[model samples]
Structure formats: structure tokens, C-alpha cells
Target: MNNVEITRAGLPDISRIVEIENNLFPDPWNEQAFRDVLFYYSNTFFTLKSDGDIVGFITAGIEDTSEVLYGHIMNLAVVPEYRKMGLGGRLMQRMEYEFIVSGAEGSQLEVRVSNGDAISFYKKLGYSQVMVIGGYYNNGEDAVLMMKWF
Candidate 1:
């Protein structure tokens, strides 16, 4: 099996990451959004590469927008061809380590409520459902608010 390389998002890697983003999400981040990430954010974006190809990625940030600080996972996507492998978990474990490096002691994210497989995956990784968002996705799909403490 090929080894996966995980690192922070870098300058020359935006195009392939965008390709995966577009193919994975209906409301993908646009060009400016991506540029903002690559140019402006340093600690929030991380990518996983396999055989020098961008296969999966995870985006997270400090949840300072709320009253208290927390690590918040914004996005986690693995290309369909690469699913069923442990790449997603690996990417998440790396992101969590980075979040703790930045002084965050806990993390939170929302998962689509209907995605039982994803929910199981997160739970297996020690995440617990804390609540539910009524209309979390663009299509009004519900989402489960899950949190993990470091």
C-alpha cells in the first residue's frame, strides 16, 4: 500500500485540493475562498497527499468566535475512490494533533445526520454527539453536533 503524507496547505498545492473539494462538495469553496485559505490562514488548513497526489484534506480552526476557545473542524473530505481506507482517520488524527499544538483542548464538528457511516466513523474515533442543528446544510439537512476532547 502507498504511504500517505500529511502537511499544512502550501502554495503549489491549491489546484489539486480544489479539484477534490469541487468533486466532493456541492457548495465547495470558490477561488477566492481557497486563496484566502492558502494566503491568509496558516494554522487552519491541512492536506493529505498519497503518491504525491492530493487525495484528502481537513480544515480546522480555533473556535474563538464563541465565548470560549475550542478547536472546530470545518471540513473533512476524502475522494470517493480513496474511501474505506484509513486516510480520513489519519487526516483527522493529524488535524487533532495540530489543534492541540495550537493550545486547543477540545474540538467540535457537525456531521450530516443521515450519514450513519460517517457518524460511526467519528464515534469510533471518540467523538460524541452533543446536540443537533436543525438546518445545518444548504439543502436543509439536519446535522449532529459532535465534540471531542483532547
Candidate 2:
């Protein structure tokens, strides 16, 4: 395993990130969503680089309330070749750190209801199931909303 570098994604990294997305998820983010993450929310969108390759990545945004702020993890993926090497953990840790530094009181994400592996991962990371949304995906699959507080 090489040094895992977590950094914000630049315009040039968009294509590779999209490739990672397509390789990792059954339904991946579209090009415009990737562009939005970089162009509009670059500060919170991040990628994990190993030997100059995008091995893992995550995107998030801040939500403000009257008394505090929160962070929402929009998407996360780790290249199949890079899985089980702590790359996913590294990416999540980086995102949580950013949330804390940005005064976010909590973090949230929604996962495919049937994705047991991801559910377990989030559970180990201290995220607890909060709710479920019916027919959340384009194919009418359900989704589970999970959350954790820093």
C-alpha cells in the first residue's frame, strides 16, 4: 500500500473520479453531478489518491441550522482493486475530519437498503440507521438513511 493522500478534487480529476464511480457502484453519478461537486462544492468534495490514482473518494455538503451545522455525505466509492486496504476508512476519516473542522455537528448518508456490505461498513464507523425512504432510487429500490455525530 502506498501513501494514501486525501485531497479536494480539481477539474482535471473529474473524469477519473467518474470512472471510479462507474466501476464501484451499480448506479453511478452522472457527469453533471461530478462537475457540480467540483465546480460548486469543491471545498467539501474530496478524492483519495494512491500513487497518483484515485483509489477512493467522497463528496459532502454543509447544512446550517439555527444553532449548529451538519455535513451530508452524498456519495462514496473505493476502486475494487483498492478495497480492504483501509482506503475506505481513510476517505471516511478525512470526510469526518472536515465535518468537524467546519463546525458540523453530525454527518449523514443514504445507502441502498439491500447493500449489506455498505450497511456494515457504516455501522462500524458509528453510523446508526435513522430512517428509510421508500422507492428512493430510480428503479424504485428502497434506501436507508444513516447518521453519526462527531
lDDT of each: 0.84, 0.88
TM-score between model 2 and native = 0.95
| lDDT of candidate 2 over 1-150, digit per residue (tens) | 677798889888888988888877778898889998778778888889988887778898888887879899999998778888777887888888989999999999999999999999999999999999999988898999999988
Q: Model 1: per-residue lDDT, tens digit, 66-105?
A: 5656788878889988888888999888888878887787
Reference-based TM-score of each model: 0.89, 0.95
Among the numbered candidates, top TM-score falls to: 2
Off by over 4 Å in 2: none
* Top candidate, metric lDDT: 2
lDDT of 1: 0.84
Query: Any residue pairs clashing in model 2, and if so which?
Result: none
